[model samples]
Target chain A: NAGVTQTPKFRILKIGQSMTLQCTQDMNHNYMYWYRQDPGMGLKLIYYSVGAGITDKGEVPNGYNVSRSTTEDFPLRLELAAPSQTSVYFCASSYLDSSYEQYFGPGTRLTVT
Target chain B: GIQVEQSPPDLILQEGANSTLRCNFSDSVNNLQWFHQNPWGQLINLFYIPSGTKQNGRLSATTVATERYSLLYISSSQTTDSGVYFCAVVSSGGSNYKLTFGKGTLLTVNP
Candidate 1:
């Protein structure tokens, strides 16, 4: 089903530069999430959406924004990239009504210079 | 915010051996999941066990919700099993789907 897909597997941005990491899932999931993982650390949630047009900040949401305009897409925006934002980003989706297990994307590795 | 802690931060095991990883949460949780992140950086769902015990092939997991802890057991390990194992959970009072991850237990299986 192509499950979940993310664009620009790797990216390098300069301080103050802005970019968006794209995430899409073909599974018709009702819940989508964005998370960042630093070296030797577990993933920290950045933002999540329950459905189209519903987005909320997560545990570590600073320096980032998100929008879920459609059921298949949830994009994370980095407004002003910082060195601290350099980490591998992951997108996940799941059906809240059933099979609550999350399916993660391949991850986008970002480096802010 | 819920706190999750995984033990044996690092471990090295020979092929065909067995190992156990533990995850402890600071508060009650409504959901728990186990994942294996391979060296190539793909997170594979191992189990969605929030409580009780479940087994799949050479791997099994047991969660004691009342105790707020979970255990993952790998039997007959192989080189393919080398990776970082994470235990994630959602606190009972808040968003049930918002997973809080433990730092993870890095497992290295040598042939």
Candidate 2:
């Protein structure tokens, strides 16, 4: 299986610009998540989906939105990019079971200028 | 919100040396995992151990759920093992799908 995959390995956005980060998983996982990691810091959850049509805000969801239209896809939308939003973004997926061992994607590095 | 803390934020070890990384959580957790982020920026899941002990090759992990702490052991470390190690957990009382991550322990193994 392809596990989890993300698009646009790197991106540079201007202030107020908007973009969507794509994430897909072929593991048939019922749970998907978006997280951002700053340099030298741990990752912070941005958004997550329990299943198709079920999405929820995570720890740092202020500047982001997400949608789970299909079990295979969960996309994160940035309405207005800012310098603070510049970070390495990661997408992960896991089975919806007692053991939520998540598998992560390669990550997208974004820089807001 | 649950708090997760990892110790020895930085470590430098010689090749073939052994090292241990620790993760401590502020609350009870239903899920705990260790991930190794290589220099190339790929997060590889090392262990999905919420409790008890598990080992794979030169790496091993032990979690004491009751104590809310976990340990990751790397024996005979190699330069390839140089990277950031992260520990994440899901609070038993919080959303099962959300994981709180620790700052991570950065290990540098020199040949």
Candidate 3:
């Protein structure tokens, strides 16, 4: 399987711009997550979905939105970009709950100017 | 909210040396995992050990849930092992299985 894949490996957006980060998994995982990592820091969850049509906020959900329309797809949207939103974003998936191992995408590096 | 902390924020070692990384949590956890972030920015799952000990190749991990601590040992490390190691956990009794991550321990192995 291709595991988890994310689109737009690198993106730069001007202030007030908007864009959607795409994530897909071939593993048919029931749980999917979006996380952001600042330089020299660990990742923080932005949003997650337990199944299709089920989404929830996480530790740092501000400035972002997400939708899970299919078991293989979960997308994150940024309405108005800000410099604070600049970070490396990762997409992950797991078969079950946290008890199960998670697989991560390569990551998308976003720069907001 | 659960708080996770990793020790030795930075370490430098020669190739073939051994090293240990630690993770400590403030509350009880239902799941714990170790990840390695390579220099190219790919996160790789090393182990999913909530409790007990597990070993893989040159790496081994042990988690003592009662004490809320975990340790990762790398034996005969190589330059490829140089990167950041992160420890994440899911607090016990939480409906959401989101993971709380520690800042991470950065390792630099020189050839």
Candidate 4:
């Protein structure tokens, strides 16, 4: 079903470099989310959107930005990336409200030096 | 901010064994979910169970929202089940639709 897909499976960036992580869902989900999982830590939400043009900040929204111009896409951008930003990033989508199950993408591993 | 806590931060089980993972939250929630992150860092949805009990293959989950706690059972453990299991919750109010996650329970099933 191609529930959710993310691009740039692995990436390495130098400090101050900016890059964008792409995410798409074919499930026609109305909700999209971005999360980062640090080693030995649980996932933390960076940003989310309830639908196109509707976005909000999550637990950890610093150093990142997101845009949801279409239902199938929710991309996260890192500006002036820092080494602390290095982590495994995941994108997810859900069909119903937050009460329902969320489908997650494979994840993108980013390393900033 | 709501808080979620998972038990037995780390566990090592033998293949064919049985184990139970628990998740506790600080308040009432409208929904709850469980996921297993594989060794390759892939997040796999295990159960969408917000309440009651549901079983799939050798895995089952039960959530008593009233008690603000949930339990996941893995029977006949397998090496494939070796990974991190996370539990998340969405509180009752719509003020926040974000899922608050627990630290997770790391399970290593030896074959």
Per-candidate Cα lDDT values, in order, are 0.93, 0.94, 0.94, 0.91
Any residue pairs clashing in model 3, and if so which? none
Cα RMSD, each candidate? 1.3, 0.9, 1.1, 1.1
Query: Model 1, range B20-101, lDDT digits (tens) per residue?
Result: 9999999987779999999988899999998999999999999999999999999999999999999998787776478899
| Best prediction by DockQ | 2
Candidate 4 residue lDDT tens string, B1-111:
789999989999999999999999998887799999899889888888878999999999999988889999999999999999999987776464777889999999998
lDDT of 4 by residue, A30-67 (tens): 98999999999888989999899999999899999999
Best by TM-score: 2
The true-versus-predicted C-alpha distance at residue B98 of model 4, in Å, is 1.0
Docking class of 2: medium
- For A17-41, candidate 2 gives per-residue lDDT tens digits of 9999999999999999999999999
TM-score of chain A of each: 0.97, 0.98, 0.97, 0.97
**What is candidate 4's DockQ?**
0.69
User: Model 4, stretches more than 4 Å misplaced?
Assistant: none
Colliding pairs, model 4 = none
Clashing pairs in 1: none
User: DockQ rank, highest first?
Assistant: 2, 3, 4, 1
* Deviating ranges (above 4 Å) for candidate 1: none
lDDT of 2: 0.94
For each candidate, what's the DockQ?
0.66, 0.79, 0.74, 0.69
Residue-pair clashes, model 2: 0
Candidate 3 runs further than 4 Å off: none
